[model samples]
Target: MNHQERTHAVLSASGAHRWLLCTPSARLEEQFPDTTSDAAREGTLAHELAEMKLRHYFQTKEFGKRKYNAEVKKLKTEELWQDEMDGYTEIYKDYIKTLALSFPAEPYSAIEKRVDFSQYVPDGFGTADCILLSGNTLHVIDLKYGKGVPVSAEENPQMMLYALGAYQAYSFLYDIRSIHLVIIQPRLDSISEWECPLGELLEFAEYVKDRAKLAINGEGEFCPGEKQCRFCRAKAQCRARAEENVKLAFNPDKGKLPPLISNKEMGKYLAYGEDVAKWLSDLKEHALKECLAGREVPGWKAVEGRGSRDWTDMDAAFEVLKEKGIAEEILYEKKALTLAQVEKTIGKKDFAEMVGGMVVKNPGKPTLVKESDKREAITNKITAEKAFQEEQ
Candidate 1:
């Protein structure tokens, strides 16, 4: 499968849910720089790996065994490559093969196919990880690499957009009457699929068209909630989000309440519990950044949180321990307690008397805390070392 470099649109299909729900976020997010996380890098690597294997499976002639082996070797050499990724990619490949077999005949396959849905979403386009078109069916498969959340294909705007794009691109060649949207999240051991008639898909496109116009023009309401805001770049400082969470946390307008909270109200509160916590965390992170940038964030300041310790030289440090008559077994067991855990178990006094001389402490990383926090306020000159092997 040939890979296509993904170029994100202002209203990209991947962020369809966010933009569709919080229509103004697309413009709001443009204020912040795009950033990638370690997890996202790993997911990209996983996609590369999965694409290589699937290309080999579907286009065996063009992507032969020797070429496939070379690609696999190159992918395995990636810094973020994990041993478990091999199994996960294999799971994805096997699922695709199984899906193809279920079709009446050999399906036409495309890997990392770029699809344009500009008709519905202005300048919208996204890469379909895999597309299998056969007879009357159009299948759009998406490989989700993250285990943190299990994405479903049922009415998933991202999957729907991809399916729409595939249909627009292939319906002329194939008598496509039905559409299948698939989410293969192997890490979560889930394979969710949603199928619909071509007519229903067209209706979905119309719905998207209405929202896309609002999103592209930045004319829609700033509806702030969890799902839509999860990946929004502007989430941390969005006034709408702050206001919504504030209301959720303290619905003072409810005035007087019953002695006991009603079950219905409790359920509603519980539903937004994670969202409220996440918003507060994001608020603190935003304020911390402002303070670090030399801006005054009224009641908060940055200070040293906690630092991890590590050995400058593991072998030399262990040698010192051996000289101190400490056996190797006591010092290792999947490398035993994380310093603090060990100290707590052995009693801090005993730990200090026994092994304290062998270890050195490092100051914690810069952190944001209340102005009244007892810890002394310090500049952002923090550092870190290997957690269990700090140099003495």
Candidate 2:
């Protein structure tokens, strides 16, 4: 084992202590040929530790109460402890079943190869989470317990880097034609799979080699932006800090006439907004190209974007309650509840019976509503619906 692998072993062992463990170096960051900042390091570490704790909590039911109580104390809030526990337990059971069928190996939490990508030298190097030689293929599964959009495994630089390493380590012994890169993200409800062709994989290895040479020779500037900056630890000391103001301008809250906005401040905001828009457009184009560069899966299209939430139909809800002899006055006065809270509030059996045959209408689709648009849309919808009902 090299220095990186040794460090990972130490940290993984220490991670059993829950909160006291040190962070493991990200394989991608190590292979990137750029120095990562402390802030970025801290953020990544915190995310990993939270994932570890969540995994531990779900794996063993005996410590459920203790873990829940610890979370309550740490967060200093009594909100959603039981609900979270219930959801975690359900998901954990499902995942355990998935592992049993997919892996069937003895220890569920075993680390196969750590930073073992030395074979594809002068190209790229990465630490693989686990490599299971099942049947004819090698399954390289990377666990990303994060809540962000699942990392696409197809043409992923990190996965390719690991494949390069695997080829060097085991190509002589095994006739490996394909590298299976699987991202298991339980939190985001996403599972992504990518396969690498040997030829293309080698091409990417060359690209990595060229990039590393540029980075080492200081041939290119480290151009940081919102996407990368979000996780960058060196932001405070980074020269890019001055550029943040420009990025924040295009943020969701830009045009809102804040209670206080001086003319000078407004000018600065507008200037920053313009810069951010251009930067984001360029970033998106680059990412899209990188994603589709490798082999394509048959009948598999790029994922579609999901809409966000808007207002619920309170008036419709009231009408439904009225039909059930629940007075609007009483209903309006009572606290509103989320779907899950309602389940717990009335007990599962009663709640299920109450909504058994009822069809729950969704709120209208989400739109980018301006303040002016919000009032007009709500008024128009309510008025139109009322008028049509009256005519009927």
Candidate 3:
């Protein structure tokens, strides 16, 4: 796996949108350490694999080095490697190859390139996965290994910042007129793109400059919202976030529900419901951690739960079961895994090739959801049914 290097800047492009929204958070976050989760590790592994494939295909000898080979060997053994990862990286690599040849002149291509935006933001720098620079345009492509959330390219600050940084790195030699940002999310079968003129890009740079100044000086308000607090390290303790979540209930008393819940009220809940659920889970995790570390919480305590028994020797256990004349039905239970899980294991394309005709989806049931959700909502009532008249 390509190990995630510790970030040096207080504000990198990855968190620019968040810090831009809550400037003080940039300062506050410095007090805490970086926390790498399993998902992040998986993402790094996926990127490493993608980079390796590109290096090989592009005929770069760097991937043949001992360092790269050792990391690749280590990463491939981990559980994150899947058949689907191959398909995702192929899509990303193929796009980069196509984008390189799309323009009139042969565009210069760089993989896993470091970009600096320190001119606009204090110590601002990031590593863009793939950058293609041509005469009057540049194509910046990013691979998102995540499947839960589909990343969009429309007005995306991270991509915009990457473009700005790339422009800073290459504009002296190339007269760039337009910038293109592409987000490739193969897991979700999505490739979103956006383009902007050089004028608009400069305008955004001005906005980023102002925000960066405030963020560096540690002099901005803590206005909590869903996007800002989604990844904040101090989210649980932030008063603004707590207040926003508390506003969801007129009264959270156990005895009775809120007196009113019209469509307007329901709208607020739907919008903020995911954030509230995340807060609850975060609070529980925090309390459990504290208790495990010898700190006491007011109303909660951790206790061991009932666990199933296991045999010391599987062969002996099987022999004993046979000796007892136990039926196979009692000895084992059978259940099939879902297609989604199998697809992820085998890769999306291969899963279809292997089991395309074997599966069918049932019509979905109606459910209330945010407008942002990809799926269309099914209405509860079908209005104005036509009545049939008897034919002559």
| TM-score of structure candidate 1 | 0.82
Q: Best to worst by TM-score, what's the order?
A: 3, 1, 2
Residue lDDT tens for model 3, 1-392: 24477355788888987998899898887776678878888788789888877776564565566755675677679887765667788888888787776778766878788889989999998888888887788888899988887888888988888888999999998899999999998778889999989899999999999999999988889877778888888887677777777775343435656787878867766776768777777778877888899899998898888999988998789779988997767877898878788888777788889998898988877766668776766665553442233231
Best by TM-score: 3
Which lDDT tens digits does candidate 1 get at residues 166-274? 9889877899999989999887788888899989989989999999999999888999988898889999999999889988788743567678878777666677676
How high is each candidate's TM-score? Answer: 0.82, 0.45, 0.85
Q: Compose the digit string of candidate 2's lDDT tens values, residues 101-186.
A: 67555322323354454333322344565554544455566655446555677776666666666667777777777677776665
TM-score for candidate 2, please give it.
0.45
Question: Which model, 2 or 3, shows the larger lDDT?
Answer: 3
Each model's backbone clash number: 7, 3, 0
Reference-based lDDT, residue 373, model 2: 27
Off by over 4 Å in 2: 1-112, 119-127, 216-218, 236-337, 340-392
